[model samples]
Target: MRLFIRLLLIPGIVGWLLGGCSEKIDPKPATYSQLLTGTDKKSWKIVSYQVLDNGNASSVIPAQSGLDACIADDILTFYADAEHKLEVSQNAIICYPNEPDIYVTDTWTLFNANASLEFYLPVLNGKFPWTIKNLTATVLTIEYYFPDINASYRFTFNSTTTK
Candidate 1:
């Protein structure tokens, strides 16, 4: 009787241990807006900027495009609020001495089923639309075309913070 009881307990113990190792339920995937803004806000820093001609990478910024190096450290943040505020922080470096450290704009929208982002820049005095090439938890790629130059600029940004 003792041996039989021991065999029964061994199986029960093994089964309980295996049950504890089962996979946990996964949370739902985040939406585009959630990925862009995170829980409350998110900050992104440019990793690469390339100029495209006829859908080909012709040159890279700051090397052939004459873009300032200061732009690489800037942080673009989006807030998940009623206004959907957008802000850019010119960290440590600024292209111009008179430029402000932070630029804020309330006029921003995610349109075309959240496949595109449009934001108004007071300094530029116009609203610009960027095609959302890709947006993930860690990376965001957007493209903008300049009609006058007949070229497209692709910007890849890495998420600095997503909270």
Candidate 2:
């Protein structure tokens, strides 16, 4: 009888202790925006571009193409005519091997001048071994990697005001 009581009590105590120690996790919300540009005139140029980290470089878009730039508080917004109509948006938490606790949200709109269509894509930002940074004003560069596809891409932007 004592043995049976001891076994039952031990199990009950262990279960209660474990249950009480469990922690609750909260889900993070996604971010999205639909911004309207004001009358303030600004322009950006794709002066030079490169895909990935390769040494090769290309001209920023075409010469006659139109580019736009807008500033919103802490973030700068760039817009171009979406002939391709590609748009993407996503939210993700990154657990980088070297740097943890990194979180990012990304949205991209792709347009092809010849295709007369657009691509809208949203993906969770990933943390890579190489740090990703953004440079704005005269030039802006964004680096991203896709874990699902095992690929990475880079975009460069250049901005100038028309007098």
Task: TM-score each candidate.
Answer: 0.68, 0.27
User: In model 1, which runs have C-alpha deviations exceeding 4 angstroms?
Assistant: 1-26, 59-66, 95-100, 112-114, 120-126, 147-150
Model 2 misplaced regions, further than 4 Å: 1-41, 53-132
lDDT of 1 by residue, 43-141 (tens): 877776777887678555542134455666667788988798888777766655676778545546888575888864332335689889999999988
Q: How accurate is candidate 1 locally (lDDT)?
A: 0.76
Best-performing candidate as measured by TM-score: 1
- Candidate 2's C-alpha lDDT? 0.34
lDDT by candidate, in order shown? 0.76, 0.34
Superposition TM-score, candidate 1 onto the true structure: 0.68
Superposition-based RMSD of candidate 1 using all C-alpha atoms, in angstroms = 5.3
